[model samples]
Target: MKYDGGAQNVLSEDYYNLVIDQSGNKTAQGVINVANDMTISNSASFLTSTNTIDVSEQQRWRNLNW
Candidate 1:
């Protein structure tokens, strides 16, 4: 999902299993959590001088052949 706004947006830890695709201009207050099954595709940038990219990679295999 794409979060576009003028103010700073905060990404919660509740969305640990969600697929988030970032686009447009956005400002965040803290780090963004990347889930094991989640993928963040940043087509555009919303980074500032103070902002940082701190994403965690949780590697796990899913049974796609089921």
Candidate 2:
């Protein structure tokens, strides 16, 4: 998914798995927090490229039930 120029996408701490296959410029003009077990596979064309992310906070959180 493309994190447009002004949108801050937050994947909050939850009990699940997230898998994403994206292409083009996945630029996070704002914060983009990808939680645990998130498998992000970019396209072959953008495979050698890196995403620009602005992390406002930590990506992972401790499970209280554990």
* TM-scores for the candidates: 0.37, 0.29
Tens-place lDDT digits, model 1, residues 15-49: 44433344554445565554445333455345435
* Model 2 TM-score relative to the real fold: 0.29
Superposed Cα deviation of residue 2, candidate 2 (Å) = 9.1
lDDT of 1 at 30: 62
Which pairs, if any, clash in model 2? Answer: none
RMSD of 1: 7.6
What is the Å distance of residue 49 in model 1 from its true position? 3.2
Candidate 2 per-residue C-alpha lDDT over 29-65 given as tens digits, one digit per residue, 9 for 90 to 100? 3333444443445441112124333223444332222
Worst 10 residues of 1 by lDDT: 57-66
Best by TM-score: 1
Best by lDDT: 1
